[model samples]
Target chain A: MAELTYREALNRALDEEMARDPKVFLMGEEVGEYDGAYKVSKGLLGKYGARRVRDTPISELGFTGLGVGAALAGLRPVVEWMTHNFALLALDQVVNNAAKMRQMSGGQLKVPIVFRGPNGPAEFLAAQHSQALASYWAHVPGLKVVAPATPADAYGLLKSAIRDDNPVVVLESEMMYAWKGEVPEEEFLVPLGKARLAREGRDLSLVTFSKPIKAVMEAAELLRAKGIEADVVDLRSIRPLDEESLYASVRKTGRCVVVDESWPVASVGSHVAWLVSHNCFDLLDAPVELVSGEDVPMPYNHSLELAAQPSADKILGAARRVLYREDI
Target chain B: MAKTAKNGRNTLPPREILFPLLETMQLIRAFEEKSGQMYGLRKIGGFCHLYTGQEAVATGAISVLDLSRDYVLTAYRDHGHALACGMEPAPLMAELFGKLTGSSRGKGGSMHFFSAEKHLLGGNGIVGAQIPIATGVALAQAYEDSGGATLCFFGDGAFHQGALHESFNLAKIWNLPIVYIVENNQWGMGTSWKKVSAQSDFVATAAAYSMKGLVCDGMDVLNVRDVVGEAVEEARKGNPVFVEARTYRYKGHSMSDPQKYRSRDEVDEYRRRDPIVFLRSRMEEAGLIGEEDWEAIVQRTEGLVEEAVRFAETSPEPSLGELYADILA
Candidate 1:
């Protein structure tokens, strides 16, 4: 096994995929000479040259369109949005073209494209930049959405995404780029639509993904200190969600708390709560609790931003609520 | 009767080619006329856009394509483009009927006919949405350097979208093998092109992208064939060309359009210079097609349209299972 950061794992995945397939290519702003806005594509320009690793002129819709077009024309493209925030500019191309091309064309075409960039609330980059937009993407039928919280998963899931035949969205976190983890030394692929069991326990089930999973794990540790053993489910892939695993966990635990980075209404956590409530209706001992970000727009102030997002305290409170610990 | 084209472009294809070209235009006209009638009869549902007056636009452009290698993608007024690209009429009509035998297996209705073997991409519904995609297809063409070119057709109303400009800029910089043809049919739904476009002539604006641009009479079939054929050749040499085909739509934008935007006089003015009539007369005056030949072609197109209507009527609707099938694979 080799240790690496989330950014390195992503770079390794792209480099390996580009080397493996001639039909695969990279396109986005600064993916070449500028070495990516976050340096995730650090040396790809020199390694592959401009022919494969291209630098685009800040044209999200244009390049994203080009990516979808190339995919339709039988080329695999990895379209890097500088961030999910900037991706909104190309939302039409993604939502309308990439998502609908396969079904609308009656399966005559396959959009083997990836729209990858940093996502979710990060630090004090309030308002536009701090929004978590994965649920909106998950709402679409033709897309496969995944977010990896560790270096190993970042490598494995991205490698699978580059090879996937459908349009895939990889919602990486800006906050987790420097976070390091052990990845297999050799090639491996974490298949899409599988959820990993981060921690195994018996008292209650903690459900979450991406950046918020960290706080949920900390909350699990706090619960463990109080002699409350809790199982944690990391939903690596948001869409094609591993309902089988979630149902199995909720069935065993009988109580669940979902921690989400996005707001409450129609959020990813709400859907998970809904599914658990509906499918595991007979198995439930208490109503599933959801700890989601504040509904208001992300605040610019540090303290307010801290309060606006889901944290360990919030997750701990929700877990305690589900665990029937009325008195903290 | 004029032997030379209205554009004065000496593009009189041989009798063999011109005969089929005239026949194809007749086919488009008949098919569209039937589609309009069916829309009225409620045989086809959803937003049904008719390609009534722009027959020559697709006929001319597609006539020059190397069908085995070339690619053509267009906007929602797609029945003409699909037929012109050599799609089977039965499947196209069935698609309009939302039948299982349709080109897109009945999933994509009138606005989204697609045929992979014909190299015809789906007729995109979103305005200017296909521009960037065409540019990307050109990028693939360039990467392969395979001498294949892409023809991206959109309407004048689509020119206002930001993606079109971005596509032009990218195509220019990449030197991608693509040809952008704007079918300037005057109206984008209810709004006229002049009401929205900054430049009086869109072709002249190609200078901003440092690309070659030309304007031609869209009503003239031979002219579109000659110009687009030459542009396709230039594109094979890695040059992207911008073309504006000044055409007209005889019908309203969609079946539901009241068409209060324009007058009957304007429609009649354009109809008097109808492209199909123009092509038939030119072929006859040049001794390329006899009166008997014109009658036979029209009768054949009518027969084809009748067969298509029968096929659409007989084909079965998709089973409850098919609605969920194409969403993944």
Candidate 2:
């Protein structure tokens, strides 16, 4: 079990998937010769050649649409946007075509495509670059939205996403790329819509995904020291949301706190909270508490940005408020 | 320039195919007229754009292709394209009625007709959205070694969309098997072509992508057939071809359109050279069919359309449970 950073795990997944299937390839801005804007696709162009590992002009709409075409034509294309913020330029292809093609074609055409890149708040990137829109994709019906928190999960989920016969959005966090964890060397794929119980407990269930999972785990440990055992659930996939696991954990704990980096109104946290109230209402001991990012746009200042997002302290405070029978 | 129409008889297609083209044109006209009446009675909701004067563009373009192997995709004004591609009139009418028997299982309405078995990708609602998708289908055919070409149909309004340019460049650079047909109708909604575009010539736009472009009189079915036939052959040879079919729409843009932009005389001017009249007159002069035979064909088309409406009226609306279906794998 060697320790690999989240960036390295994603690179290894792409390398292995490409080596396994000739039809599998990578395409995007700076993905080929430039070794990826985040250095996640380094050395791939040298190994795979330009045809298999193509670098494209800085036309997001053009390249993304090309990738969709390539995928429809029998190639499994791994398309990377420089950042999720840049995805707005290609929203027509991603939302209008990629998501709706399979159903619109009456299950005749399968868009086996993957749109991956770093998502969520990156420090000093200001409002344009530093925003979390995972919930925006999760709100759609046909597309699969995934945000894996750990390095191993990043590798496993990406492999699964490439193999999926439907469109999948793999959102990675830019700030979490260097964070390291143990990853197996052999081939493995984690299924979509499955949640992982990162840290099991009984007092309060802390549910989150992507980068916030780490913060939730940290807060869970801090709460454990204060004699409050919190169960930490990492939601790997958000679209085919693992409601079964979420409800089971909520039913067992009788209290829940959802943490998300997106805003509170119409957010993933609100949806999860709604699901809990709708499906697991009888199991609730107190009202479900939610710790979400502030509704305001992300500020450029370091302190302001940090305060805008959900943190371990904020989650811990939310958990205590639920435990203390306070309005949450 | 090289005198490629050597077999003038072949260039003028046999009476057998010509009669079929006439039938298709009449069917489109009658179908759109009936659909217009339906839309007035509060039957079909949402956007109801008609392709009344553009029937020759679809009928002529689809005539030269092998429907079994080739794929066809088009923009929102797609009823003619769908019928020309061999979709049964019943399912199409049912689709407009929001019945489960429709091509899209009643979910797509008129703008999203899809038939996988016949290789009709979709009647996409968004402008210029199918350009890249059709190019992708062509790329897929090339990847699978299927020896098929994809025909992408859009309108003059779609040329303004940036995606069309992107699709044109990539299709040319990759040498994908695709024929990009731009039906240059004079209006996009209420805006006229001359008003919106500085250069109204769409064929020159194709040259910017280093693709061969041909412009044909969309009001003449025979001219459109010959041009599209050559373009389809060129596309099959792994060269993407672009053809601009300069047509007009006799009806309003959609059901809700007031058509306050153009005068009634402009509509009558286009109606004078209607494709149906051109085909029938040519057939009568050539002794291909008698006047009585042409009348019978019109009667048969109207009967078929009436039968389709009856089928659609009897068809069931999709259950609410269907909302959860076809949304995932």
Candidate 3:
């Protein structure tokens, strides 16, 4: 195993996939020569040349739809949006065309395309830019959504997404790009719809995905200090959610607290809370708590922005409430 | 009517080559006439847009394509384009009937017919959504160095969309192998182009991107064929061309359209120059086809449309299990 940053792992995934498949090409604004806005595609331009690592105009709807078209025409395209904030401009293409092409066309076509970029709240970049729209993608039917938190997962899941025969959205985090982790030297694929048991404990289930995994892991340590072990379920894929693992963990712990960076209303966290509440209705010690972002626009102030998002302290509070140990 | 083609050709194509163009146009005409009748009889439901008077635009442009490799896409007024690309009429009718044997297995209705084998990407539902998708398809054609071109069709209504501008810019800068054909049917639904567009000349819109721009009498099959033929060659050389086919749709935008915006006299004027009649007359004047040949062509198309209706009526609705299928890989 070798240590690599999240950005390096994603770059490795892109490099490996493009090298493996001649049909694979990368397209986005500043992806070539500029080496990508986040440098997640560093050195791809030199390695693959302009035809493969293409730099596009600031046209998200056009390029995203073009990527879908390329996929329909038998080319695997990885179209990068500089950020998910800008992806909103191309939502019509993502939601209308990419999400519905397969089923709408009666399975005649497969949109083997990946729309990858940094997502979720980062420091100082407030309101429009600091939004985590994972639920928006997860809500769609034909599309698959994956938010990888670790360097290993960033590598494996991205490779898997590129190889996937359906349109997949890879939700990378700007904040986690510099975070380093050990990844396998040899090729590996962490299959979608599978949850990683980050910490196996029995007191309560702490479920989360994406950047919140770090805070939740830290919260798990805080719980361990209080002589209360918790089961941490990191949902790598959001759309084909690993419900079986979540249910299993919730059933074992008999309590659950979901940590999501997106706002509460109609969000992935709410859906998970509902699933646990409905399916595991009988197997609960206390109500399933949801620790989500504030149901308001992200404030520009650093302190307010941090408060708007779910933190380790917030997660710990939710876990304690779910475990009936709030006094502790 | 020995008309010279716009490609500087002394004469049009040979009788064998020209006969299929008329045949395909007739087939599209017959298919659409039947589809309108079916919609009236309550056999078809939802948004059923008929391609009545604009048959030549689809036939003329599509005839030049090598369908084995080339891609065809269009807006919802797509049955003609689908039929022109050699998609069987029965499945298309079955799609309108929402049957299991439909091209999209009844999932995609009138607005969404697709055939992977024919390289007909889709009859997209949105106004100008196909432009970027078609541009991307051309991106593939260029990346693979395939000697193929993509024909993307949209209406005058799609001109105002930002997708059109963005797609054209990319097509020009990337030098993708795509031909964008605007079927300027004079109206964008109920609203006339005069009321909507700041620039009425659809061909001039291509100049904004520095792309090759061409125009054709969409009512004339030979003119369309010549212009689109030239554009296809230019596209294959990685120069995207935009062609404005000045045509008219005889029917309402959809079955539900009142068409109160235009007078019956205006419809009559365009009808007098019907593409089907124009092509048949050209063929007859050139002594290429006799009255018997025209009769035979009509009979064949009518027979195909009749068989399609029968097949669609007989085909069962999609099974309950199919509802949950095809949403993912």
Q: Output the number of the DockQ-best candidate.
A: 3
Residue by residue across A189-220, what tens digits does model 2's lDDT show? 98998999998899989999999987898898
Tens-digit per-residue lDDT, A1-328, candidate 3: 9999999999999999999999999999999999999999999999999999999999999999899899999999999999999999899898999999899889888899999999999999879899999998999888999999999999999999999999999999999999999999999998977888999999999999999999999998988888989899999999899999999998898999999999999999999999999999999999999999999999999999999999999998898788777664
By DockQ, highest first, what's the ranking? 3, 1, 2
Q: Is candidate 1 or candidate 3 better by DockQ?
A: 3
lDDT of 3 at B125: 94
Worst 10 residues of 3 chain B by lDDT: B1-10
Chain A, model 2: TM: 0.97
- Please report how far candidate 1 places residue A253 from its true position, in Å: 0.9
Indicate the residue-level lDDT of A253 in model 3: 88
Clashing pairs in 2: A73-B140
Q: Which stretches of candidate 2 lie over 4 Å from their true place?
A: A19-22, A46-49, A69-75, A106-108, A325-328, B1-11
**Model 2: number of backbone collisions:** 1
Evaluate fnat for each of the predicted models and list the values in order: 0.82, 0.49, 0.86
Q: lDDT per residue, candidate 1, A1-328, as tens digits?
A: 8999999999999999999998989999988988998889999989998999999999998999999999988999999998998999999998999999889888888899999999988887989999988888989999999999899999999999999999999999899999999999999999999999999999899999999988988888888888888899999999889999999999899999988889899999999999999999999999999999999999899999999988989988887678778665
Candidate 1 segments whose C-alpha is farther than 4 A from its true place: B1-11
Q: Each model's DockQ?
A: 0.84, 0.52, 0.87
